[model samples]
Target chain A: MNNPADLRYATSHEWVRLEGEIATVGISDHAQEELTDVVFVELPAVGRAVDAGDPTAVVESVKAASDIYAPISGEVVEVNPEVEADPSLVNTDPYGKGWIFKLKVKDAAHVSKLMDAAAYAAQIS
Target chain B: MISEIKSSPLEAAHVVLGAKLVPFAGWNMPVQYTSIIDEHTAVRTACGIFDISHMGQFIASGPTAAAWLNGLLTNDIAKLGIGEGQYTLMLNEAGGVIDDLIAYRTGETEFFLVVNASMIDEDFAWMDARKNANVTLRNESAQWAGMAIQGPTAVEVFAKVFPDETLPPRNGIMTTAAGAVVCRTGYTGEDGFEFFSPAAEGIAWWDKFLAAGAKPCGLGARDSLRLEMGYPLNGNDLSPERTPVEAGLGFFCALEKGDFIGRETLARQKTDGPAVKLTALRYLDKGPPPRAHYPVVSADGTVLGELASGVLSPSLMTGIGMAYLPAEFSKIGTPLQIEVRGRLFSAEVVKKPFYKPAPSA
Candidate 1:
């Protein structure tokens, strides 16, 4: 429920934090807690182009696997290799170390379209 | 949307203890409280209780209850003694399993049976259609809720609450302090008690169990426990399309009995040897947990079978699973490959109860 000031959220639970043209993406703490003991994380490869709302990643919990959709259309510039090596990172710190990928946002202004910290907190709480 | 699912009587209590709910048998059943591994380990090493009220129960009684039930189930009722709970399966006339259940004779003409919640409707219809003139079958599921408290220390937890030997000693049944139909039984590989009570009162019973120092566990831990013991759960491991014999559940099939709905069919299949036999597979290393329906293939890439149930065994601390493989490849030491996430992982067929049951179970 920590509404990190730098991040925006999607209704589907993905978080996006814009830094100039790049938007780092990951899931929220509320999400990891619901998923429980993440065992596997499938991250989108760097340089891959994704459209908004597309399935770009997957996080597998002990019981089930869920899709992590792309929050906004962008090109993947980098992915969190740490999560691939250790999916439990999502459980430990989904917002920081567990951030899935760095996106080269198609439009930096698109960040405005997503849920702000207060709105995302309202959505989750 | 775990919260979107309906809550059980114990939902609030479960959330208060930090349970993770998942859709199970049409209800939002808690899959775990702390972690499946931690909870699983606790039940195996100490004591744990589960809110299993979502499981369906029914009462069958009349002048000819035994005969009527014998005609419909796969087990030999003649082998049962009053107050003793027996694990058995209900099979269709085609020899396929309807559900794996427990039958307990509460009286000379009365009996209590538990069935899977998902199969309640169909099970009721099937039992009703097969009812005889001297017997009556009633679906008592909606009125009841159940709890399964299992582990080496399980008896101690219950003893504190329902003392004076209110529990059925070592797998026996007795009325308890909570007015529960306390059955000494369980699916976990441990000594345990399963309490059946009014649905409205289940949450209170759950709270008492927790207060008694029993860890609150859920369906995820339950699944791991049963799998570690190689117990076949209905619908997943055993289904209407697969006979108990093929499912490696022949132990529960009473071939000595006669005239049950699937008696002749099951008897023949038993002699013929089930075409596909259930086998336990242990991943060679600490690999990803196998999943249901993952293809099991021969070394030459021939499709041998498919995984019926699988998970990272918190008990074994390694990936474990069950599959229906050809009888020829069912040897305990056979090496196998299970395709997971579009890739193959090496595994081995091992003599199971993949986990060793504590001496108490």
Candidate 2:
């Protein structure tokens, strides 16, 4: 599994890359592999406020649907339209073009408190 | 209250193929080898092999076997000639389905039955309690390992694997020189055969089919393929509380044949019409794949029923499912909604099968 050193991750397998107060969120490679062949993605609505651990989106495969949880409390800033048109992007490029949504962080420090690449790798390993 | 999970004879082969194993019908079975869609497409366009050892097999013999089975099963066993098979159902006295299976006349007085894995003990006990003196029933499920090789290319793969043997006609059963039984039948609407042999030889036969160009498929692909053809699954689409009539399987039930268990209720339902019908539905727009137990709603937002089975059809690239809706709502072109989580997606009642395969060459 590729755990980029610059990105922090939640135990739920979502990776967040913080830029200023904006945190870009997407499921990690390990999560995408577990839920293979993503056929549909339900993105969270913009401006929706979510607390940490809240299920903000859904990623579905042929077999079952999974909840993509909010790693940290934030307001939904933007959602990825690319995944909506072609859901396979989540499986093909989970970390880059497959990002699910962007959130305006409530507290930017919370992003640092989450697991770093090393700790996240250890947990998944 | 925990029970032991059963293992297929070919479990080791599945592990070697890197299959994702899951618990299904109290057995550790592979859900997929590579991916459900990939395997499903293989079975649709090429050839795919599935380990069906988890299903149950039984042998019934004696001079009166045919007459006796005809009384117990919904199909008229008298119609089957030697080496012929037909899909039939065993039902409770109240007309509810006990199990749906294929009964093959392997000989003049002997019949072979392949039943759902979870219904083995119950089906056996139900039959044994009512068995007549002239018939002898035996459960040989544990002695056999089964595999279904299915697809348009299945015949080609079979020819490559068994160059000396000729495949039986559709719904026909033939024994190979090595004592293996090959039946020209499968759940997927494709030209294929289900092979059964001694339990110890499962992996060898599996390897032979694979070497002959059959792709290894798991329960996931098997499910989608069957559902695409609108085949009813025993535990999912069929149950003890529902009769075959409500399941849209009246054609398989021979009402004109003499008396049988559950015939009275089926006959009554056929005349009076079932209040609920197992209706097929397709999503009108892109949505998350529907699944069993999802609440189905009417146009005016009335809760009609829940889905019996549902999936994002790998072939159609749209959500398709079956639900036991009220008879009035079961008609074709009726509008419906499938509620996933809290969102309601529009769907419409359509024909039984969501897909149709190309005719075999």
Q: Which of the numbered candidates is closest to the native, going by highest lDDT?
A: 2
Q: If chain B of candidate 1 is superposed on the true chain B, what is its TM-score? A: 0.95
lDDT of 2: 0.95
Name the lDDT value of residue B361 in candidate 2: 98
DockQ of each: 0.37, 0.87
Clashing pairs for predicted structure model 1, backbone only = none
Q: In angstroms, give how far residue B41 of model 1 lies from its true place.
A: 3.2
Weakest lDDT window of 10 consecutive positions for candidate 1 chain A: A36-45
> For each candidate, what is the lDDT?
0.84, 0.95
Q: Clashing residue pairs, candidate 2? A: none
What DockQ results for candidate 2? Answer: 0.87
Candidate 1 residue lDDT tens string, B157-220: 9878776765676657767654679888899879889988888888888888888879988888
